[model samples]
Structure formats: C-alpha cells, structure tokens
Target chain A: MSVEAMLQTIKLLLPALMPSWRFFSVIAPSPRIEITLLKTAKDTPDSWQEFRPRPAHLSIGSMLKRMFYNARWNEALFLTSLAERLSSNPTEHSSQEILKRIKAELVRNSFDSFDSAATPHLQFRLVFVHREGEQLQKHVTFISPVYGSFGDTDS
Target chain B: MSLDYAIRLTEILLALAFIQQSIEHFRAPRDEQRLFIPRFILSILLLFGFQTQWVCLALVILALFILRRFQGPYNGGSDRMGLLVLCCLSLINFMPSSLWREYVFGYLAIQLVLSYFFSGWVKIKNPEWRNGQALRDVFQFSAYPVSEALRTWMNWPRLLVVMSWSVILFELLFPLSLMTPTTLIIGLVIASTFHLANACLFGFNRFFWIWMAAYPSILWLQQRIFIVEQL
Candidate 1:
C-alpha cells in the first residue's frame, strides 16, 4: 500500500488503540518532541551529532513508521530501565536522581555493547505531561532525552 | 530467468534469512526470544520450500496471528515484511494452478518496490536526510553502530549528498528496472547490494534477507507482464 494510505489506516485505528485520549489533553499537541541532552555538542564528538528521533519533517505516515520503530526498542528500553530503577523506591520525587541512575545503568549495561567511537557520553532527561480532565488530572511521565551512541573505544 | 527458477531462488533466500533471524532471536535474552522462537522455527520450516501447501498456510497464519502478537513491541518492519512475503508465498503455493497467481505475486512485488520508493521519498523531502545528516545520525549512536570510521563521513558533506541522492535515485527508479529480464536482474543485484550494506553497517540483517526473498516475485511479475506484452 502507498505510505499515505497506510497512514490513513493508522489514523483510523489510532482512536481504537488509544480510547482514553478524549478524557484528557496531551501535554504536547505536536507529535514532535524536542529534547536537549545533558551534554553539549562539544562534549560529544560522535559522528552522528544527535540521537533523538526527529520526525519533525516527516509526514504523519512516516512519523508513524518512526513511532513504530522507536516503540519497538528505544521507548521500551527506556521505560523498562526506568521501571527497574524506580522499583526500589516508588515514592521518589527526584527526577534528576532517577535520570542520573538511569544514565549510570545504561552505561553499565548498554555502552560497552554499543562501544561507538564518536559519542563521549550518554544523556537523559525526565518529561512530565499532564492531562486535565473534568474530574481528575492525569500525569504521564517519561524520560525526555534518551539516546544511544557508539564512541571510539581506544581499546 | 524462468519464473520457476526465480521463485525457487527466492524461496532459498527466504529460508536462509528467516533461519538466520531465528538464530539471532534465540541468542537474545530468554524473555525476548520465548514467544518468537516457535514462529521463527515455523518460518524456517516454510523456507525449506518443500512443505505441504496446508502446512505452509497454517504456519503463515500462526506466525502472523499468534507468534507475531507474542513478539509484542519488538516486532516491526522485519516481521511485517516477513509476513508479507509469507502471505504471498502461501497464496502462490495454495493456488499454483490459478491464473490469478501471477497477479498475487505482482501485488507482492509492487508492495516491496513501493516500500523502497516510499522510504526514499520520505528521506528526500526531509532536510536532514537530504543533507546527509540523517545518515550520520543513524550511523553514529543509534541502536546499530558499526565503527568510529563512520563518523568521519560527516566531515565530507559532498560525499554525503552524493550518497543520499544515490539512494533516493536508486529507490525511485527500482520499479522501472522491472521492465525487462536483464534490467530486473540488474535491479535485484543492486537491491541486494543495498540490503547487504544495510545489514553489514546497521545490523538490519533481517531486512536484507526478507527483501531479497521478494526479488523472485518481482522477476516473476516482470516476466509475466512485460515479456507477454512484448510478444
């Protein structure tokens, strides 16, 4: 099928897949999410400058493709790692501490396997989005800036 | 090439691809592999290309509905493309004598071709893709990174531009290559090389084989439509 047609199909099905959208508003109405990592461009010398998913220029159909690909691994990895870290203290309020811990865990677990030469560091951030409803407020929280990079392993 | 040989060749490639993917899946953490193992096994069986029609059909359905669902979020393009190829294979197998089988295979070929075009079309329109930045970004620190040398390519914007255009042109013109047997062979070779590069550079090994498996269908359609029209 054409990409346009495929997207139309997805648009028709999105409502069914996410039935609770009507109950609350999205934090970012725009599909694109811009995130600034913890490190500056100078600190990272990776061949690939950015690690975020840039769907800003994509059509809805292409964006859907990115979403599918990201959800398959990237998003899942972040959420799983976060959940694991959060398991120890469910009431923790320090997003910064949690982010730091997540970054450390990723370094310990993922960096060596992905040993790329260009990226100097891994960075992450926390994003809290609130949905206001008639009777209650729903807050959805996730890591905003999570990226993987392969740096030159001198070894 | 003859349609018979073309189809057989595709079957071989498909079998190899799925078996490789299954092995990779098996190597992953148990939690990830558990649900996909059975489907991968069945796909490998179907790849043998000698299975009974009913058996192949059953395997395809099971892989699509049951095994694929179990794979959960991990499943994406590879699974979707694999399913497409398997469905086409099943349809072709179940109705070997039907005149409409050619159309079924044609549809598969068209979808594969469009997949390429759509990907390129999307990229060409995006400034990041056009400037070669997207390529750099993907190679740098994404899920599949091969080496540090890939980063140096960013320094040469001209090279990146040329490479980006090459890809876009290749994808857009891929369908035209199906106009003749010779062109179709050439097209398949080029397409195979592209997939091979993706596999070696990005670990998209599954895409390599699954896309290769679709080649025979394209060849079949070309021979069916263009050759007959020439006659």
Candidate 2:
C-alpha cells in the first residue's frame, strides 16, 4: 500500500488506540498531548475521554497539523500577502494570476513542512466585504481553489 | 414497513443535502483544495443516487481522510453529524445482509437522541442558557445577523427565558419521542421546525438539511426496528 493509504489506515485506527473524543488544538497552560501522555501511563484506555478529543472536530493528527499550520503564519506570509493584493484588486485576471503564483511559490519554496502526509494542500480565496453606511453589506469573493471562480453576494 | 423503503428515502434526502453543501463549498472552496476532491466526488455519487456500496464506502472513507487532513471536522456540529450519517450509510452498504445493519441503525438512533440530550444538558449547566441570556447575547452579535425585531426581543428577559426553557425542555425530552409512532411524528415535526428556525436565524442551512436527512433513520429505529426488537 502507498504511504497515503497507510496514513489513512492509521487515522481510522487512532481513535480505537487512543480515545475517541474532542480536544482543543491548544490547551491552556500546557499542550493536550503532554497532559494526555502523562495521564495515559496511570489510566486505562477508556479513561482517555477525560482528555476530550472531539473526534467529530479533531483527531490526534489533525490538531497537531493545525497547530503547526498556525505556528508558521508569521514566517510564511506568502499566501496571505497575495490574498490581500487579490482582494484589493478584486479582478478576474489578477485572481487567476495570484492563484497561479501561489501554486508556483508553494512548489518553488520547497515548503516541505506542510508536505507531510498528514497536512493538506492549501488553497486561497480573496474576499471583499463592502459596507452599507457603517454596517458591512455585501461580500465579493474570488476563489482560486475552484480554478478562479468569482462569487458576489449581498450579505 | 420495510427497511428498504426507509433507506431509499434517507439516501435521496442525504443526496440533496450533499449537493447543496457541495455547492456552498465550491463557492468558497476550502483552503485545502486537493484534499477536498473526495468530497466533490462523493457529492456527485450522492447527487446521482449511486447505490454502489463499495464505491460509496471508498468515497466516504476518502472524505473522512480529507476532513481529518484539513482539521475541518472542527468546522462545526454539522460536519460531525454529516460524517456520522455518511459513516452509518457506508456501514449499512458494506454489510448489507449482516445484523450489522440493525446495530448501526440502532447506534445512529441512540446517537441522535444523545446529541440532543448532551447539548441540552450542557446548556442547562450553563447559567446563560438557563436564564435565557444566552439567546439574548447570541442575537446581539453581528455574526448571527438578527433582524431588528428579534434583536428587540432580547430586552424581554421573561420571553427569552421562556424560549430558552422551551428549547431546553424539548431537547431534554427528545428521546421520549421514541416511545411511540405518534410521539415520534410530533417530535420530528417540532425538531424540524427548530432546525428550520435555526437555519433561518443563524444561517445554519447545512445543519437544517443534514439533520432532516437523518430523520429517516430515527423514524426507522423508532417506528419499525425498535418495535419489532422489543417484542
């Protein structure tokens, strides 16, 4: 089997091995994983529910992936910068170009951290929120992930 | 009377829900585009009413992986509930002849009842939800887009308390809906209206449709399967 298939199998089995529950990506004062591992030695498999891993929203792997993703926001502003530019321009051709640029940059930068079997390939969307008086009125959205589709709506 | 009829109806409603949600996702496709391809594929299968069990199972599994990868089962209760429904459907498809089908349906029915119970129980533990302040605070937020009329109702603490308690009581008593077919129909109607109101008020359209899709399973368990098994 391929590595991807192996990883998928691991994810499915993880719940059984660990506890199937909900957990915050970041637990205040200390990480959930740290606490879970510490507690695991003394507790039975069923006792993991106290750690609260919401399988519906989070799994052991995904929570870590999100933490890593968020951690890199400061260092990797390439996508966000492009998104800002695209949102400001809010044009069809520019949106497409920004998307192409992002894909190329992802490859060129050798952003290997996010290339883990666990992490997902990122896409970008540019959203423009227009105002009616002081209140936000509408949204003009340009999506790069859908091959550069544009959507506009009065929110 | 047969499980076949219930399954067919559930499948159709689920298909429509998937299609509707897929369109919304397509509008502002997830940040992880490649990972979401399985979701796109599953939507197609569901929309066409594909009954190919193995293929549907593969697609559902793929979709779950994508959800895991994106850390998006975190999106909200809807994604979680949708995954549950899909998982249950796949299990039924995979083991068509085994008692596994009944077990899975029973599991779903129990989970459905638990969803409401736990939500109500959790809220009742909170002071805000108990006193109606939760609704009042929720409507005051711009994210929810409350109408001026609804927003004004926040000032009436007594009314808010009544509304809140109504929700709390109904949700707490939801499992009792399983007692009889008549109660089940009445409960489902009230629950459907609750979801509808939530959709209208909170823009939780996905929850509205997907929860409705799960109704057939609940109906099957309460009216048909559970009755037979109890005897």
Candidate 3:
C-alpha cells in the first residue's frame, strides 16, 4: 500500500489506542492501577499487605515498586496455602519452604493455563479502572496456580 | 553577549560535560565494563572534537547558528566535509560488528522519523485537528506548575495534537523539504518545538540545544553559505 493509504488506516485506529488528548494534558495524574492494587491488598486479611503505593509516573523506581508488591502478595498466599495442604501448621513452616511453595504456585498458576511464552515468569495481577463522567472506579483480580507440577502439561 | 561568545561558551560547556562522562565510564565497576564501552567510545569522539578537531566541530556549530540567524543563505565553506568525518567516526566507534552499529544508528533514525511521522499521522487522522481543537490542547497541556484559568477555555487535546502532529510530519519530510525555502522554514519551526519540548519535559537540556544547532544550517542555509560542486 502507498504511504498515504497506510497513514489513513493508522489515523482511523489511533484514537482507539490513545487516551483522549485532554487526559495526556494533566500534570501527574494518580495511577489507577496502583490504587486498585492498594485496595485489593487491604481487603485480603489472610495475606501480608505491607506493599506501598508507588508514585504515578513511568520510571525505573515505579517499575521496581510494582514488581516487589506483586511478588510479596504472591509469595505470602502460596506459602499459607501450601502449609494447609501439607497438613502442617502455618507457624511451623520455614521461610525456605514458603519460597519453594511460592515457586510451585507460580508454575501451577501460569504454566499451562496462560500463554506462558509471552508472559514473564514473575507473578502479576491485572486491575481495571472504569471512568464515568468525572468519577473513577477500580476492580482488581488476583490469579495464580492451585497445586501442580512446574511443567507445561495440564493435569 | 555576542553570538560568537555564546557559541564559544556552549562549546566549552559541552566539551567539559563529555569529558566528565568519559571519566565516569572509566570509573565504572569491572562487572559493568561491557556497558561502558559504547559510552567510552562516544566520550572519546566528543573529546577529540573538543580538543584536536575543534575547528571542524565549531564550523558545524557555527553553520547551525548562521542558518538560524540569517533565515536565508550566508557565505562560508560548507561544513559537509566536517559532517561526513563526524559520521564516519560515529560509524567506526560503533563497528567491528556491523550489526551493533546498524542497530544503534537504525534505532536513532527510526526514533527521529517515527516521532515525527506518528505525531503528524495521528493529527491529520483526527478531525479535531482540522477544526483547531488540536492547537487548544497544546496550550492547556503546556501550562506549568500551576495551571491558569485559561485552560478551561481551550480545546485541550485537539490543539496540542494538531500542532504536535504537524511537527512530526514536517520532521519526517525534512530531508525532502530542504529543497524548498517555505518547506525548510516549516521543518525548522517543527524541529525547534521538538527540541524545546525535550528541554522542558525531559531535561535533555544540552542535547536539545546542541543537536538543534546543526539542523537550521544543514537544511535551510546550505545554498546561501557555500558553493555546491557538481559531481
């Protein structure tokens, strides 16, 4: 196709991909995803919720904050669940055992269920934010493995 | 201060900055040695331009200033030879493997072109730009630390996007635009805005200033300054 034709196609699709230009104009708007994560952590009493909300900007520091926060929640729950399954008391389980359990949990949750090739091995949660007029609302989903081997074959 | 003084001061500042960067590269830890090589090479090239080949570098810098100042042509030897040399040095510093050199150069070229093209493409693609909303968007978004009440009066997204897109399209077509006076002026205006935005938003102060110094001269004032030899 000609350059002009290709540009026309892109022009048609651009608005769908980009937020309204007014949205970009705001100076340091609050992060919708981070707020959702904070609310989710607060609701889950069984899991450790020591994660802090990162500043609403795209930077290396913010990326690290998100990574650590996700890992912390995933690790805590995986260990707790493993202790229960093994018929061991939670207080009796060692930190090393917790880490092993978390790894296993990740393998089970991610391996066969999702397109693991495109996804990183690290645990992540998706949050959706809905905006109505001037008001904003958020929903968070936490997903992971039940119990299984690390390989790709489904059980 | 005079333009000559301003240029001289800028050259000295850039030379010092590059030297400091080169020192930092050398001081990086052993584990970080691989990452430093490219930086180290760039530092060496900048240092060479500052110390030994200052004349050629200065000429290119001066060429840029001249283009911006006169808006038409000026008289002098064309700095094309100096530019060619710099380009060659940039190539060698990145070489030994053609892949690495191409990857680096290609990425920069793609970034320059895409930044312009995508911006323009999006603008022209939108109906709001045609209606002058794009300009209003620019005024609103560009408001500083505290926004003025005027933002409420502007068509925030439309105005900004249109202006931004115009810049990108102009830049993408700059090489071709060099042949005509009007197109060259449009390209320079777009480039100036791009550099200005980089300085304001990203704090790429030196790069935005120094790199832009070359464009006006190279694109707009080439014919007025020096005689072209027929090949």
Candidate 4:
C-alpha cells in the first residue's frame, strides 16, 4: 500500500494518534454553565445558579490528594470543553452532546427549589466570562429552551 | 537513570495515573462510566509488573476506547502525554533490539522537552503573556483557578509579570539544561514543581502524574547522549 493510504488507515483506526501539544498560551473567555428552574413561561425563573460550583472548598490535604485522584476535576475540564464548543458553535454535535449531558446531570441532582412547582422545568445557559481588572464580567452566549427534568427527555 | 529503573518508574507512575483517571470516570452517569474498566484492569496489571509486555500491548489497544469515549482527549495535554507514554512502552517492550528501544525513548524525551519549549515560545510571542495579562486572565477568568480565593493573586500586577517572565524563561531555556546531569536534574525538579503548582491551583492533577511518568525518559536520554559523546 502507498504510504498515504497506510497513513489514512492508521488515522481511521487510531484517532488519538494525532495530537496538538500547545497549551495555556492564550486567555480566552471561559465558559460557565448555569441552570434555572421555571414553572411557567410567565413565571419568572428562579435566580440562576452555577451548574457545577467549584467544590465548596478543596482543603490543602484534599488538594494534595487530588494530584493523584482527580477524575472529578478532569471531568470538569471535559465539561468546560463541551461548554466552550457549545458557546462558540451551537449547531455542532458537541453542543447537542453537552446539552444531553447537562440534562442528565440536572436529573441526577435535586432542583434548587424543593418547593416543587406542579410541573417543574429546567433551562440551562452557557455564559462566557472574562476578567477585567479585578472584576469578573460575563455575558450569556446561548440558552436552551426549557428541558424536561429527565434524562435525554429535554425538549 | 538506568533504562531498567526508568522503565520501572514509568510503569508505576502511569499505572497510578490510569487508576486515578478510571476512578474519576467510575463516578460518571451509568452509560458513560463502564468504558474505563479495561483501562483500570490493565493499569493494575502494569502496576504489578505482571505480563508487562502483553499488558502494554493491551493498554495500547484500549487507548482507542478512551479516545472514542471522549471523542478526543477528555483533558488534552495530559491524555496526549499518557497516550505517548503508552505507545512508547508498547513499542519498547515489543521491540527486541536495544538500539530501537533507545530510539523510542529518544522520541518520547524529545517530545516531552518540546512540549515545554513550544509552550514557552508561544507565550513569549503573545503580547498578553509578555505583559502578564495572560496570567492575570488565567487567575481572574479561567475555569482553571481551583478556588475563588486564588483570584486575590490578581491584585499583584508586578508579581504576575515577574512570574510570567519566570515561566517563559524557564521553558525557553529548558533545552540547554540537557547539557549536563546537574542541569537536567535541576530542570526536571523545577518542571515537576511547576506541574505540581498547576495541579494545586488548577485541579489539573492528572497532568502532574502523566507528565512525571515521562520524565525518566528524559534522564535516560541525557545519560545516553553523554555516553555516546564519551565513546
């Protein structure tokens, strides 16, 4: 086989073989995920809460432990990538993937308002945040229509 | 470092890395979680030095599932480094000749060094990184900051500038450190500390272990070059 054909075959079989190593050079807007509970279109949605609040406080010992046991944080990074893609290109497959994942996450956790609405619904949005001086600034880049509070069942 | 010693260190470190990563994935929702099982098992096998050659080959095959699971590296550089180490170990273990194994180790060491150098080169070139704005933005805006408390570091503009320059210079001059054993050890220490600090501040714990897994390759390669010169 030609080298080009061989290379093409390898690429198909081993997708992870290609990698770009450039890291942490540029500072771009960071994506933050937020979700709100809503009862009706007319009902003002409850104030937005950060979807994955930085674990309240990772103590020094815990932080040290995380150096070896940090799959949770790695997942956070994965989610951030999904959020970034969703914010930048809402029509892409990753955006849909993130949306499904978010719905699944919300279903697995308790809603903020335990005072359940007759028919509770959740809507999530991607916010792109940047720091200017000491103040953190943010703007909502994308919002999903109200999703049913069930896995992959979001409208 | 002896090749035997380096290989042993790498196997253990990479094993710990895989186990930790699998533990994390184990927490994911049911559908997405089971994918790491084989990786977890192989990592255990690799750690114990059980059927190492066969285990390396299995892990190499399993890496495909990992990439497929995340569509790419779930965490880019760490996963990339992990895969590189995987491929290197697999090739070195299977290849019978010492010379070919040395070449594989060389490729890994060169890549490891260049990861730092190119990162520093790009940062130095960027106006934001040069002025410390990039570091400021990282502490201030990036999701990387492990805690809201870290943003307080943003108050010291001059300190940020000094730190930024320090990183740029260290990474840029890293290649020169390979000249002698003393410099190489110092360079590796500083580099590992840098990764450690990043792990603490950014919760990028995986990067710390995966990168460390590759360092023995650098030490091994350094010794090889000096021996070649002596010959």
Candidate 5:
C-alpha cells in the first residue's frame, strides 16, 4: 500500500490499544482507617463516648510509621515475657544465655518509639506472637490517637 | 513543483502523527477526561481524510475566509467584526493556568524570532559572539561523546566562532530582511535550518513539522508559489 494509505489506516486503529495497556499496569492501593472523634457530654450519664465508624484515608508513609511502631513494641513485650517465663523454669538450658542475647539484639534493632527523651506521640505498641515449631513474629499496632476509651475489637 | 505534492506530504505526515497519538489515547482513554473522547474521535476521522473530519478542516477554511474577507477593499467594518470573532474564540478556548502548556505554546509562536533576535542581542551584549569565540564555546560545550576528540580539531574553534557570530548577526537583522525577497529567503533558510537542527538534536518532531508547514505561508505572502497551471 502507499504510505498515505498506510498512515490513514494506523490513525484509525490507535485508540483501541490504550485501555488494555493501562489495566495490566501497576494500580495504587488505597489505605483505609477507622476513626472516632472524642466528645464531652454534660447532661448524659457517660462523660466520654466512642463515636461510630469514621474512616479516614491514611497515606502510605503514615501507615508505614504505624507498622514500624507496632512491630517494635510487640517485640519488646515478647522478649520481656519470654525472659520471665524462662526465669521461672528451673531446668533452663545453658544456651539460654545465648537466646537472651539474641532476643536483646532483636529488641534493640526493632523500632523504639520511647527512648526516655522521645516525644510521647511517637510511642507505639508492637505485638509479638510465639507459635509452636515456628519462628517468632512481630506485628505493630498504633496507640489509637483518639484516647478516652477506644477498645480494640479483636482484643 | 506541484501543490499536490506539498498537500499530499502534509496530509500523510499529519495523518501519521495524529493516528499514532490517537491510538495511544484510545488504549488509555481514561488518561484524558471522558469529555475529550469525541474530540479524539473527530481528530482520528480528520487523520483518515474522512468527510466527517471536515468539522476541524472547517476551522482552517474559516481562518482563510476571515483572512480573505479582511484584506479586500469591499467593507472596512467587516475586518473589525472578523477580529472580534477571532478574539472571542481564542478567549473561549483559553487553557487554564499551566506553566508547561504556556511554555510549549509560547515556544511554538516565537522560536525563530527568539533564535534570531536574542542570539543577535547576545552577540551585541558581549564582544565574544562578535569575535567568534562565543560560537567556539557553544560548539565545544555541544561536543557530546566526542568532546575529547573534538578538542583536538585545531581550526574548528575559529570557524565555529565566525559561524556563531554570523547566526547572531543574521537573526538580529532578520526583520529588515522581510522587506526584500532575497533577504527574506536568506533569513527563512537560516531559520528553517535552525529549526531542522533542533528537530534532529532535541527530538522536537511535532514543532518542527508545524513550523515547516507554516513556512510556506511566509513565502506565499511574497508570491504565488502553488498556483496550478492548465496541463
């Protein structure tokens, strides 16, 4: 075909190719969070009340901060509990010293929100889970910014 | 020598560019707002040389009609009417505040003028451009992967310096060249070459094509270059 005819044909076909190109590419995931506003009541029996579900979009950076805070707190809590349990056991292995060192390293390397001089707002909780025959895992959960009695649903 | 060749070349290139962009947009129609879909479709039709594409083709025809209407001796008042309508359309189609779009359009409207006048102004501003050293610096700076090899070329600096000053002088005096045929041709040839160089080096393919297409109109103002003769 002539160059002119070929060019004309290509122009007619371009729009059909773009939709599929976009579908297979990376899609940004939205961060969802439940929020509650604290309110003071004068005439009501309860002084403070929990608000209903108020969802706010959390940015990825903020989400990562919360995750890191939770992980560190959980690891510290786990190590403390493990040390206490081992101390109560009379027949603890000689290698328990090495285990304690390993636990200390893990706790040290993990994120710490409170270093005495650190701001109170930076403090976070990390939950540690010990499974039988499996490695210990840490999960970070933030201290709810909204205070005055908000309970964790899973807890 | 034929008008047909020029028109055919324009049509083919325009069609190719439009088609490529249209296909890209079609595959990702969501990239643009949904309202732009019909405009895209119409653009595609225009590229294909379909009768429906006449809507956009009418815009160019309308511009020509307005130009012809204002230039003649019939009615002086009609020129103001045409100008008013043009101003209204321009105002209506005004794009929102965007630095990038502003630069793109501004660059398109006056690249040749700036290349000539500003380059000339710089030559006058400094003695280096007039003496040829400024051109040498430009060429040396432009030497990419071969900068080391180019550094060894001895007389290139002198030649480039002269050429650089010539460019500035040419640009500075280009407006006066428009008054005469020979000077106009010389000025346009230099400007065209400058734009062509920009296209090859910087990949400003769209701007190059648009500028080249408009170049004929500058010549058309001087003499009828595309009149068809009875064969």
Candidate 6:
C-alpha cells in the first residue's frame, strides 16, 4: 500500500499520528440526538427525550474533577463529531458506527437485557441547533430509520 | 530542561491522559467494549514509569485498538496529541543514541510549533475569524460553550473582536518566540494560558492536559535545537 494509505490504516489501528491542526473551520449548525420509543412502525411516538441532557448546574468540584475524569462529556463531543461526519458524508464508517452504538445504547437503556422479550423499537433524529440568541433555536435535520426490537441488526 | 527530564514529564502527563481515557473505556457499562483490564493496568504502569519502552509500545497497540473502538480519535486533537506524545516518548526511550533522542524530541517541538502556526495560518485567511464573527458565533451558538451562562461573553462584541485578533496574532507570530529563552518561555506561558482558557470555556480538559504534556519536549528542544539554529 502507499505510505499515505498505510498511515491511514495505522491511524485507525494505532492512532496518535495526526498532523492537521485546523479546528472549527467554519460555522455551521450543531447536532443533538433525540429519540422516541415506538411500539410499531406506524406508531407516531409517546414522547421524545434528548439522549443526553446537559445539567443546568455545573458544580465546581465536578468541573475540577473533569480535568482527570470527563468521559461522559467527551462521549457527547464524540457523538457530535459523528453527527457532523454523517452530515458531510452520509456513508462514512464513523457515521454508521455512531448509529450502531446509539441504537445499542438506547436499547440497553430501555430494556433490562438483550434477551428481553419486549419488542419495542427506537427512532432517533438529529436536532440541529441552528442559531444562537437569548434562546437557542433547533430543527430536525435527519431522521434514522426505526431500529429493531432488540437492536440486534441494522435498521 | 534536559531531554531525560522532558521525556519523564511527557510520560507521566501522557499517562494521566491515558488513565483518564482508560477508566471510562474499561468500565463504561457497555457490554460490547473489549480490553478492559489490560488497558487499565498499562495506564497505571505508564503513570508509575515502570518499563518505559515496553509499556509505551504496549499502550500504542492498545491505543490503536481504542481508536478502532471509537472509529476515530475518541477526543480529537487531545487524543492525537496524547498519542503523539506516547509515540515520540517511546521512540526516545528505545533509541540508544543521544543524538537520535535529541532529534526525536526536536521533531516533536517542530510539530508543536507548526500546530500553532497552522492554526493561526488558517484562521488569518478566513474572513469571519479575522472579523471576530466566527469566535462570536462560537461563544454564541457553538456546541463548545460549557454552559448557558458562559455564553454571555458573546454579548461583548468589541472584546470578542480584540480577543479574536490577539489569538490570531499570537498564534501567527508564535514561531518567532522560539528565537530566545525569554521569548520562548513567554510564548509557552501564553500558549498554556490559552489552552487553560479553552478548557475553562469549552470544557475540553483533555486538550489542556495533553498539550501540557507535549510542552516539555518543546522546552528541551528550545534550548538545544531552536535556539542553536537562531544563534
């Protein structure tokens, strides 16, 4: 393989060699994940909940602890990057991985086990927070197909 | 700072970043996750400065797997910078020749310098960033604002514009600061404070730590490499 291609593979397999430093290249709408439980394909939905909600109050101790332990917040950033990736390149592997992980997490949160007999499904949409002001405005950007009852397979 | 001291700091600080990441991955309540135990142990080994070269090598491999687990960097530049520190420090440990070790550390310094330059280089070309609208928007609507209350900084337009240009100029001219020990120390402090401010504003604590870990290499190289070139 070419050196660039090899480097890309190694990056995935053994990372930390990235050379680019450009960040926040441009302003664009940011994404948030919202999901609703579905009993059937035709069911509208009972209610939608943000998959992860930022706490209204951030304690000083918790902020300090984030220096060494901010895993959940980092995961939210990871998911946001994946959503941006999905918007730019719909077929990207990272985008699909985001979908897969989100499906699994939602199922795990909703049901006790993977082997549970309940056949509930999950449908998620990307809510794009489009503008900044006294109040943040958001709109649904993309909706994934409804996931399986157990989230065992791709929807 | 001596190369040896710099390498030690790099290893320890990078170990902290690794420890921070490994904890979540190791016990994140997700069943599909793998390699829980060793990842945790190796991070501790790295932290304690056990077998330097071997531990770094093992962690590099695990880090790649961790990257695969996340499908990309788990935390963007912070993860990449953490890995870069890990990879370079391993090479520094394994390379027997003092000259080779110096060159590796110098390479990391050059990368660090170029990172700042390129960050400013790109922003200088962008109209919005130059005019402060981009940064204003960042504070206003970006996902990065740590909390809603912090977003109030966007209301101060003149301060936003001045802060934007200060960042641009500081970053763009940062390389010239390497010419002397005094300027280099000043630049490092500014750069570090900038990272700290970012961590405070955006809650990217890993960026602050990982970039701090990379600084010792630059410090060692500044005395040995960059200043020598200047002389």
Predicted structure with the largest TM-score when compared to the true one: 4
Candidate 1, fnat value? 0.00
Which sections of candidate 6 miss by over 4 Å? A1-8, A11-18, A45-49, A57-61, A91-119, A129-141, A148-150, A153-155, B30-33, B226-231
Cα distance off (Å), candidate 5, residue B147: 8.6
lDDT of each residue in B1-231, candidate 3, tens digit only:
222232333334344433332343343334224433443454455545544344434433433332332221111111122232233324434367755543433333333334445545565566645555545543343322112343453545555556555554564465565565566667667677765554333222333433443342243133332234322
> Which ranges of candidate 1 are over 4 A from the true structure?
A1-155, B1-5, B29-37, B65-75, B140-144
lDDT of 2 by residue, A129-148 (tens): 33343343434344333221
Worst 10 residues of 1 chain B by lDDT: B66-75
As for lDDT, the candidate ahead, 1 or 2, is: 2
Candidate 4: misplaced stretches above 4 Å?
A1-19, A40-46, A55-57, A89-93, A100-111, A114-119, A131-137, A151-154
Give Cα-based local distance difference scores for all models. 0.53, 0.54, 0.36, 0.80, 0.35, 0.76
DockQ, per-model, please?
A: 0.05, 0.03, 0.03, 0.51, 0.01, 0.45
lDDT tens per residue, model 1, A89-132: 43333333334434444456533333334434444433322223
Candidate 2 lDDT tens digits, B74-130: 235666677777777777887757577878766666777777776677667777688
What tier of docking accuracy does candidate 4 attain? medium
Best-to-worst order by lDDT is: 4, 6, 2, 1, 3, 5
lDDT (Cα, tens digit) per residue for candidate 4, span B75-150: 8778888988988888889777988888888888898898899899989999889998899889877888887888
lDDT by residue (B1-231, candidate 1, tens digit) is 565676667667766766655655554446546644765676666567557366467756455333322322233466567666766677778675756666667777788777777676666677767766656544433334333455455567787678878887887788788778899889889988887666444445566667778887777777778768978
Per residue, candidate 4 scores C-alpha lDDT tens digits across A1-155 of: 57775554456345334444568878889998887777664455658888767754568998898876776677778889888867665555566666666665655655455333454666778889986665778999987777655533345
Which portions of model 2 miss their true places by more than 4 Å? A1-155, B29-41, B146-150, B229-231
Better of 1 and 5 by DockQ: 1
What is the two-chain DockQ of model 1? 0.05
How would you order the candidates by TM-score, starting with the best?
4, 6, 1, 2, 3, 5
Q: Point to the candidate with the largest lDDT.
A: 4
Comparing candidate 1 with candidate 4, which one achieves the higher lDDT? 4
